[model samples]
Target: MKSVNQIAVAVAVVGISVSSGFVAAQTKAPAVKSSTATQAKSSTMLKATMADVLKASQASDWRSLNPENTLYLEMDKGRVVIELAPEFAPKNVANIKALVKEGYFDGLAMIRSHDNYVAQWGDASEKREFKTAAKKVEGEFTIKYQKDTEFTRLPDADGYAPQVGHANSFAAARDPKTQTTWLTHCYGAIGVARGNETDSGNGSSLYAVTGHAPRNLDRNITVVGRVMYGIELLSSLPRGTGALGFYEKAEERTPIKTVRLAADVPEAERSKLEVFRTNTTSFKALVEAQRNRGGDWYKFAANHIELCNVPIPVRVVK
Candidate 1:
């Protein structure tokens, strides 16, 4: 994990919501949108509801930030690409970045695996019940304000925060009442762990999402961002037989050779990856197309997409 230097900022935006039944019913639409590219026009007529219209409205109003701030984790199986949310958790992001460049995770192992929850990796301290050996460098866990943060907000209602949106390129929660905001624990999410205190665990020990929506972790821990690609690698790892998914033997643990930042890698060595821009006409149409409105196939269109489930299609161009 790498900590980005950027900071988090709260936005005055409403939650985003889409119904499931209607969207699920409307499955086959002809005129569709592109998942991975910018489509010129959508041929499908979205029988969009008033709410879908609003959420799509914010798509045009999306706030895209620098990809240089993106963090890339290198595992033996493959590189797990993660975009860090500095705006929501600056110190956490920074600490991760520093650790990555320093090769702190060069020889660590993933010891914990909780099904439908998180897959964690760090100093696999066996015979030790909860040790903080990874905390060589202590950092502030949370922040009050972040300047120049480009927060792309969701219009759907969230069960977690006053508002929900994308910060540091992941689904997020914001609360004006407390002047606070943080990352939401959605699938493919990456988070920092703390023991008892709010800032207990530094960026040294971290975890990634593997299963369904784990909203319980929201606001309780620091969720950085969602996995942009190669989630199959992390989510598919074998489950541990012991409690908390702790491997019973040293051989059972997954070794982590190193973690990296995309900025640090050479262009040739770096993964030639392109993430579909969030605020695109094609994406909006794709979302609408996926919902299946104005079609016979779909009995009803959900007219909604989850922050975690939102298909952020990634591809390597030929």
Candidate 2:
């Protein structure tokens, strides 16, 4: 019998054809010319560090998350906040919201905690019925690329996709030839787990990536949303002993208190939070700052950064 991890890896092998133009655009290095004018310009510009950029940011640089699109996952340890990306997976998000509203995940427990992979939770016994939610949802691995979508393009080249950027506060990738855009498998990303069929998994069985960015999973699964806070609660869980990191016994699972939509929670009990706007100039400056690290602590500044390495800052409103 094949292990669950092997099956997942096998399912992720979807063929993607990269256009020649796309490859040429990303691989070509910029022409470097040593000129007196360039030297003078470089000397005059004072580069601001990421901290300095944040400190100087205006209120417009940040936006409050919509209550309707937010989720509060409560456990014995604490609450984990998640922001749903309805723009990316509308049907899946709606299904997930329905499942959440019907108290489908209240009694469920964390069944799998894979080392350097993901932490998954759901009805491990497969006994729970989908009262109001769909048993299967069409996989939304990628959506038709909309021209009006908010995509702040990252200059860095990625091996997985032709173009990588931030879309609606989520790390994303696109292929112009295919005219498709998909959310990436960055840390804290929430994905629906399935068996063999692409549409087999619904929102009932959800997992959060807690380790390295599994870019291989991109365009292979439906990424519903991402955890905005309390990722440590999932990452800190004991690694499962069984194959594919599933708990061998029911007693080993951690119980879930409830998973409620932020809008459903009372105003007094809600967590007011804000995330840095990626479409703003301040975000560009922040990215530039990170691309070239400042301060004397670093001996060498890695002038490049991976798409998943970019930090999406979030803050609690006091």
Q: Compose the digit string of candidate 1's lDDT tens values, residues 182-206.
A: 6777777788866877757767778
Q: Clashes per prediction?
A: 25, 0
Instruction: Provide the global lDDT of candidate 2 against the true structure.
Output: 0.81
For each candidate, give its TM-score against the true structure.
Answer: 0.70, 0.85
Question: Per-residue alpha-carbon lDDT of model 2 for 21-110, expressed as tens digits?
Answer: 222455555545346534433421347766577668788988878899999989999888889999899999999999999999998999
| Model 1: residue 98 alpha-carbon error in angstroms | 1.6
- Residue 125 accuracy (lDDT) in model 2: 87
- Candidate 2 wrong stretches, greater than 4 Å: 1-46
Candidate 1 accuracy as lDDT: 0.59
If candidate 1 were superposed on the true structure by all CA atoms, what would the RMSD be?
9.6
